[model samples]
Target: MLLKQLSMSAILLYSSSAKSLDCAGLFKDAPTLVQGLKPFVAEIHPANVTFVPVGNPAYPDPVPDLPEFCRFGAEYNTSSTSKFRFEAWLPKSDHWNAFWFKVVLHLFELKIGNGGAAGGVDYREMAIPLAKYGFAVASTDTGHNG
Candidate 1:
């Protein structure tokens, strides 16, 4: 199915088994999270840093004052001629609350975001603020280049 057809639940179903996701151990544990999913084609490698620093030249739109967080990305081979890609930012577990949902009193908050564009997944600007405030966020390219 194309990315446009997938519901948020369907996208998250692939990673439901990851009870606790942390950046420090992601380099070693990320593969297991994406394992056993059909059409899966993620080749996760060991990253040298726990988090990308502010103003790093590596990103296309670097946020100057964004807080450090763990960045994760993957691509799934949806078909012989197409691929779907996405990126997720997790607040460093040690630095802030990392839960996707919080239940305190009668209120619930889910901080995930679909901050992207039709041209590409551009979550950097949106993800930074949420990550700074202790929430995980994500965005997708809808299966194409920027």
Candidate 2:
């Protein structure tokens, strides 16, 4: 469905599902998210598609010494460094296990002033429900104004 036809609530719901998709299984389909988001977003594009692994005490810590720290799976086009980038930091079981919520989405710029547009998805609100569910999620602007 086109983004214009979708309600903000719908988009928010869709974005919230970021965690349900498995990066390992869906990395090859990264473009799908971009394509899906295009109609809704203006110039801003989904530069990177990341799949953060679910963090739990059962699994080894990503950084060892930082047993509380973990990393999720990520997917992106290494060639388009200037366009877009995304990353996610996972919380351990001791903290909020946000493995179900795909944590981060970073938007980059290829040129000056080429940043986020007004009609983009409400990622902040989209993250609220996840946070309410005890998920620790985060997203950055990558120093861009958007």
Give Cα-based local distance difference scores for all models: 0.43, 0.30
Candidate 2 residues lying further than 4 Å off, grouped into runs, are: 1-21, 36-81, 89-133, 141-146
Steric clash pairs (candidate 1)? none
Candidate 1 lDDT over 22-75, as tens digits, reads 443544444454542232222222223323323222235533444455455555
- Model 1 CA deviation exceeding 4 Å by range: 1-24, 36-59, 99-117
Query: Model 2: how far is 26 from its true place, Å?
Result: 3.4
- Per-residue lDDT value at 63 in model 2: 21
lDDT (Cα, tens digit) per residue for candidate 2, span 1-146: 12211222232333345554333323333345444321211111121332222322221222211223222222223233422223333333444443333322323321112134322222343234333454533332332222
Best by TM-score: 1
For residue 97, what is the lDDT in candidate 1? 55
Give the lDDT of residue 125 in candidate 2: 31
Clash number by candidate, in order:
0, 5
